[model samples]
Target chain A: MAKVSKEELLHIANLADLNIKEDEIDNYLKNLQDILNFANIVNNANTDGLGETIGENDQCNVFRKDEVKEFKDNELLLANAKEQERNMFKIPKVIQ
Target chain B: MDITNLTVHELQEKLAKQELTSEEIVQAYVNRINAKEKDVKAFVTTLCDEALKEAKEIDEKRKNGEKLSSLAGIPIGIKDNMCTKGVKTTCSSRMLENFVAPYNATVVEKLNEENLIDLGKLNMDEFAMGASTEYSYFKKTCNPWNLKTVPGGSSGGSAAAVAANLVPWALGSDTGGSIRQPSSFCGVVGLKPTYGLVSRYGLVAFASSLDQIGPITKDVRDSAMLLNIIAGHDERDTTSYNMQKKDYTKTLNGNVKGLKIGIPKEYFGEGINEEVKAKLEEAIETYKKLGAEVEEFSLDIAQYALATYYIIACAEASSNLGRFDGIRYGYRTENYTNLKELYKNSRSEGFGPEVKRRIILGTYVLSSGYYDAYYKKAQQVRTLVKKEFDKAFEKYDVLLTPTSPTVAFEMGTRSENPLEMYLADICTVSVNIAGLPGISIPCGVNGDNMPIGMQLIGNKFEEEKILNAAYTFEQEYKFREKYQPEFKG
Candidate 1:
């Protein structure tokens, strides 16, 4: 069975952009390990000559006319934003 | 008139005859919701006022002798994941709890065009993740059969509402077994259409490739009726197929003679409850009595289906969920020092434990060093599973199996162990993996008198065959009245 340690769990949480609380780490680790072990069953599958399936169908490169239809609900669109200024989403300082 | 007990078609007939007004129908459902919502806990929001307003307008249109769609004036609920313009489309998560949609999902739009009254948004597992609705950030939806038992999820609310007759029908999305399994537990008809048959636009994505919105209703005919209205091409959803238009209800002739039904032995193995097995066997015997050929076959790829489904579903979810950064929409955290911390903290605070677990597992499998061992291997197995289904379909018209291993379990029974919870999806996930259409209808009652469901899976775009077969079985079984949820609470 696959096992996830504290360090590994922390690293994964970081990669996934999730801030795990200090107390929840052990629980997360144990659950992650259990899920990974369950997922490890795929390794036993006979996929010697099988190709990976990324989607259900093969019709790709679907192009549409780049028509710019104006959406009239700008205020409604901005209603859910955490912080908005000058019709744009306001964010924390990015440049150091 | 017991408006709540009537099916969609019956309601339509009454409306046409002026036997019942849309206002009366909507008011009846509102009363039903008021009475049942506390125990069933099915809806996140009830649009009683809006539905009444629209129902009144639909009645006006009809009185003016204006031609309208057959579905006009019927009340229905939408699963919370589907966006309804100007309504909060929370996927039963804190992240999107207060986020109102700017546009309606295609299915919702289609229903709106038909003038079907939107009763409200139904609850579901957070981001449609867990097998039980207990993972919902809001209230947990209990099975209407017994309030102590869980409504199988993540479309638990949808199934429970229909079973309890809160609405004639509702919409649900299936990524894994979200729709069908819940319908099985709640004893309603749930249909997951062929993946691209219905547009996924405005559906909050969990796994883009696997997700498809479908119907949960009281009977096979209602499912077919709803599918007829929703199953069409939409340009916005590029993945939506542009097939020749099909009126699904036209094919429900209830004739399954000479139909080849394959029973997958893997689905009926050790973990399945003996009673559930007996119920399915009884259903198969009924099918045989209808002159349909029944045979058992080994769908060996079933062993790897669950693993493949998790890997792909989680990987896609990890990528898809990255959109909820707390900047544009969804929940935002106050405790953050910088931009990176903002992203991390908002997600951590907004999401529930099960959602976090899936995101973590999803990220882990797709991360470096483990990608080939887990994600890629799982994808390969997915292809193999699909190929195996294709091979099976060549010989059989449809595959019949139990919708779930058991009936509705007690609320807290499987919540503690996530793996135990996932096993509930074992019978239905392979249909999604293969992108085929499958329907669940009640076959009989278990020892506890809880409903047991049998699944009928068809090849891609072969829903008509399954519907014909399901309709045939449904007519004979007539379990709808016998096993109907009586609201135990």
Candidate 2:
């Protein structure tokens, strides 16, 4: 069975960019570990000759001719933005 | 006449004959929703005024002698995951609670083209994650069959809306049995087309590889008619299959003679309730009497499908949902001093517990050290599962299995156990894993009088075959009449 520590849970949560609460960590850890333990059964299967299936269809590299289609709806696109500046989404400063 | 009780085809004929105007039909459905919405909790938003206006427009066009499509004047309940311009398309999540889509989804565009009136946005699991609507950040949708039980989700409201007669038909998305399981629970017809058969453009992404929008309706013919409108190639969706568009309704001849059907032994094993099994047995007997050859088959690799599905689905979800980090168009944290805190707090506050759990698990599996062990291994196993289905289809034209292991459990019965909730998808997920078409039609009712559904799974792009087979059983059985809910309206 897979055992996940609180620190590991926090680290994974950090990687996922989620701010898990201190009280919720134990529950997340138990559930994540149980799911992982169940997922570990894949190791028992014989995959020596198998190829990974990223998608199900036979068609790949689908493309269309390069053509410009004007959206003409920037106001609508930015309608849901919490904060906007000059019709662009405004976010907190990232640079130090 | 109670117009809301009519199927899409029946309503279409009535509208075509000018016996009923689209305006009157819309009014009837609106009245039904007003009467039963409190009990069913099926809609996240109801477009009553807009639907009536659109219905009047259809009537106006008919007066001008304009051609009408099959879906003209039909009221469709769209699952909230699909984008609808000028409509609040909350994926039943707090993150998108206030988000109004700027554009319509591909299917929504097609429905609009066909002049189908949008009844409103139906409720679903938060971003299509859970097997029950209990995970919805919005109101819980109860089964119309029994208000005490869950309407199986993440398309629970879509199924419930149809079953409760709030809408004649609805659109739903299935990643891993999201459409089929709920349709089973609600005693309706739902189809999850082959992965690329229908375009996924504008669907709020949960697992891109597995998600496909499908039709949920009162009967098989309606399922086919809706599929006819939605199934096709799209330039926006890269994964959309480049195949000839099929008239799915044309294939429903109610003929299943000499068809080879396989009953997977693995699906009938442990965890299935006895009553559900009995119902499945009776369905098999019906198939046998329809001149279809039935035999027991084994899909040994299906045991690993659920585990692989979670790993792959969650991993893709972790990546796909990364776009919702409070910057672009979703929920933003109110108080954040820095950018890092902004992303963390917004995501943390925006997502529910189940979404957080899946994101964390996905992050772990796709992380550096575990990539090969979990994510890569799961992909290889997915290939194996697909190969098994391909081999089975070589001999059998279609496969039959129970849509869900059991009937709808009580609202809170399995909510606390996430593993138990995931196991409820055992009978249906492999079809998605293999990229096959599957339809769930109500076959019988269990001891509690809840509906039991039998799933018809077809090989890739074989929706025609499955629809015909389901139509045969639907004609022979008329299962809906046996289990119709007594709506008080």
Best by DockQ: 1
Q: What is the interface RMSD of each candidate, in Å?
A: 0.9, 0.9
Global lDDT of each model?
A: 0.92, 0.91
Q: Tens digit of lDDT per residue, candidate 1, span B100-153? A: 999889899899889898999999999999888999999999899999999999
Q: What is the C-alpha lDDT profile of model 2 across A1-96, one tens digit per residue?
A: 557889888888898889877787778877888888888988888888999999877777988899999998789889898999998999888896
State the C-alpha RMSD over the true interface residues for candidate 1, after superposing those residues: 0.9
> How do the residues B148-216 of candidate 2 rate in per-residue lDDT, one tens digit apiece?
899999999999999999999999999999999999999999999999989999899999999999999
**Candidate 1 C-alpha error for residue A22, in Å:** 2.0
Clashes of each: 0, 0
Worst 10 residues of 2 chain B by lDDT: B480-489
For residue B62, model 1's alpha carbon misses the true position, in angstroms, by 1.3
Over 4 Å off in model 2, which ranges? B487-489
